[model samples]
Target: MILKTYRWSFVVTAVGLVLAALYGLSAHLGIFQAIALVLILSVLEISLSFDNAVVNATILERMSDFWRKIFLSVGIIIAVFGMRLIFPIVLVSVTAGLGPIEVVQLALKGGNPEDPGTYGYELNQAHPTIAAFGGMFLLMLFLNFIFGEKEHHWLGPVERALEKVGKLEYVQVIVAGAVLLVVAETFATDHGRTVLASGLAGVVTYLLVNGLGELFNVEEHLDHGEHPEGAEAEASGSEGRKGPTGAAKATGKAAFFLFLYLEVLDASFSFDGVIGAFAITSDPVIIAIGLGVGAMYIRSMTVHLVEEGTLAQYPYLENGALWAIGALATILLLSIEIHIPEVVTGLIGLAFIVASLISSIRYNRAHPEAAHVETEATAQAG
Candidate 1:
């Protein structure tokens, strides 16, 4: 099972290790130290993103095989190169008015104590904007998950109450917008406008991506007989309607949007990881190698969960992840006012995941019939 599921992950990790060693040798660092740094970074990224893996699996299960492969393959490339390396450089270059090469050189040279024109300093200066964007995006995700109607409830009263409130149209967006305004006005004094603008942009991006995903979700509509008459006839006549060909044809559009959503979600999750890496090392290349390895492991873990039917077995796993996301979002917004350790963030998410696991186990024990039904359904779906 390990070889079948994580072969790609192992291969990528080996390559990452080799590249890390080469990078260290070029920098005149000892082999052991370089290897150790990469290991530490990989651990840090994994710790910070375990909940991310669960959440990713929840979405991956709904995707087609083709898209899942694309997510694991192409998605890893974007997560590593795009977020880990290119994003910070682009942010620094844009905000600091420095060329891309200059930004990269600064990243490699590390921060200068006397001079303020350093990559770390520039990135720090842009932290508020980054926080605003990532925090708001995550806030919307959390609110939508918690507020939407759910059949199973881990935190019964609280979840049910939120669902009731969620009945109000656009309640999630309204609450999220209000929270953004309050955070910007109260905490982000120096960069309040920038924070507000970035936060709004984040909200807009989330809405657009989510709306497009729904719009292109032809499979769900077709399966439910919600398509127009002509389309329904075409769908019904196809091989006794085992599946909708329209859905297959339109899968590309849906997959494209889903891919975009996953990429954005990964980017939001990386904001803290990228920022936290500066605390360990100022070298962007090392950070990229280390975090990139961790990200690959995450992608592998996501696929593993989907294939193993982990979420279907433990129905509350997704709920736990969303709870962790809500907490992380809150922390991100609060970080504008105070310094929150990465350890604290990781621990909080782990706590939720653990709690959810326990809850799921208890639920399964209490309702074996439901559990069996879910397992059979999952098997058939797979």
Candidate 2:
């Protein structure tokens, strides 16, 4: 069953290896060396992205099977090509005023020899803008989760206090805005305008995507005539009478928005991995193949988590992932002024996840009733 569920992951891994080997041969890199590099990159990507998988599973569990399939299939393509390859190339081309062909040539040629104008070099130069955008988006994500009202709390008192404060309208947005302004002022003095613009763009993107998703969800609920017990239903039954076809259509629409949100979330997570890849190699092709392999595994892990109902079993896991996201966002913003090692980022996230898992296990042992309640909730949600 495990293999059947993750067959696509295995297939992608196989194809990625074959492509990596071919690319290495074409580039005159030894086959073994290329394979080794791919392995290393794959491990690195998985290590950095385990929290990503946990967070993704939380959302994926709510999606339909059709959408989940699309995430595993088409989503992988976007993750690999759009993020691992095209994104870097486009960033360089646009920022450096180089044509697509020239950018490609520069990428293939690796770092610049005489001037710091190669694709990788130019891409690195654009890191501040990328960090601002991704950092803001991730910050919003973390804030929304922590500030929102939730029944289950990993850090009971702290979460309860935050949830109370979350009663303020748009508290997450307000906090995120304040953080962006503070970071831009303190750290982005040299490129304050650019950072501010990018951060605002990030906030806008998050709001637009999340708003659309909620709109679709509300529409779906209306179509189903589902409302709270005390709330009155819409008088016009036609809106809810569309039947199965309407329900399917509504689901598809909601799924599309969910897919978009997931893609953007993945992109935000990829900023670090993509930038960090440069430390391993300047060759764009190698970076794509290696990181692509790792991305595939992350997708596989997401499906695995959803299929296993891991989150339901370990209730605090999602909280852990969100906390890690908070840390990562802080690091991304801080990176503008100070150098933070990628390993440090990865370890911080891992620490949160591990701690949450241990806390969950202990909680379950102490309160078996909570486990039973979680199982029932999982069943209903499924």
Candidate 3:
């Protein structure tokens, strides 16, 4: 049944894997090596992005069908072509002071370990800026979420602490700014200027994108379809709300900004995937095709989670995903000083997700009545 919903994703996966194999053959990496590279990178992308899909679904559920169509169509194209392919090439060109053709030549030198112009090494050289930007953008997201007023508290004590602190204006910004400042002053000294600028750019970008989204939100009280009845109203209580929300007008400037916000959010998530792909192979073609395939699945998963009312059913799932984002954000920042294995990153996020899934199961079993009520509420909201 789940497979039926993901029929398109499967189709994409099949086509993508085939393309990966073909690219491998043409590159002379052997069909087996190419397939292996693609598969490893696919698993890498998928594992890192489970939290991303859940986060996206929360926003996607509130979007109108028209905009959702835009997301499902144009959104994937940007994810595949822009982030997976163009962005990496552009990054190398600009940062390495090499022309686009030279970058391509270096990328094509996949197995030449001795080449100083190796795509992976140049990207690694650029990591401080990349990590700074991605880290701060994602950290803002995590801060907004953790500091937001919510009816549910998965980690009671920790969340309660955040709730109290969130009442203060701009606490999230202050905290994020302080962290950036300290990191810039300390571990990132080598690229202090660049890191500081990139980190601030990230913060400012979040404020503009998310602030514009809230500024023009037409349906301030509209919850994403998965929200339980009275949850927002109860949380709203009076003139109060924080954190990024999906509910907005379907057309005009509101939809455009909302779409932009999602695109930015998508790019932030892709940073890790793009950088991490270097760990496997320096073949730009293989990385692009494999990660592109993985990205398609995430897009499809977002739609499935929304339509199936999965978030409403597993209430803490969102919390778990956010926790993963928080971890990712921190890891990205810390990665400047030390190397973190991709396996470790995947494991940390997966652990949170599994724990939350277990908690949600227990929650449903313990509160069978609440489950029925929420199910009905979700149907009505739809």
TM-score for every candidate vs. truth?
Answer: 0.92, 0.92, 0.90
lDDT of 1 at 333: 84
Candidate with more favorable, higher lDDT: 2 or 3? 2
Range of the 10 consecutive residues with the lowest summed lDDT in candidate 2: 241-250
- The TM-score measured for candidate 2 stands at 0.92
Clashing pairs in 3: none
lDDT tens readout by residue for model 2, 1-382: 6887778878877888888888889889878788788878888888888999999887776567778889998999999999999998898887788899998998998874224877777988888888999999999999999889774799999999999999999999999999999888977898788889999999999999988986886777566665411123233343422211122222567778988999999999999988887778778888898888899889989988877678888878889999999999999988877778889999999999999999999989998998887776555434
lDDT of prediction 1: 0.84
Q: Pick the candidate with the highest lDDT.
A: 1
Candidate 2: which stretches are off by over 4 Å?
112-115, 228-250, 376-382
Ten residues in a row with the worst lDDT in model 3? 238-247
Reference-based lDDT, each prediction: 0.84, 0.83, 0.80
Give the runs in model 3 whose Cα sits over 4 Å from its true position.
1-4, 111-115, 219-251
Over 1-382, each residue of candidate 1 has an lDDT whose tens digit, in order, gives 8897889878888988899899899998767777788889999999999999998887776567788889988899999999999999999998889999998888888773234887888987878888899999989999999899875788999999999999999998999889988888988887889889999999999999988876776665466555623355455653222221122222467668878998999999999998888788777888899999999999999988987788888989889999999999989888876889999999999999999999999999999998998888656645
> Model 1, stretches more than 4 Å misplaced?
112-115, 219-250
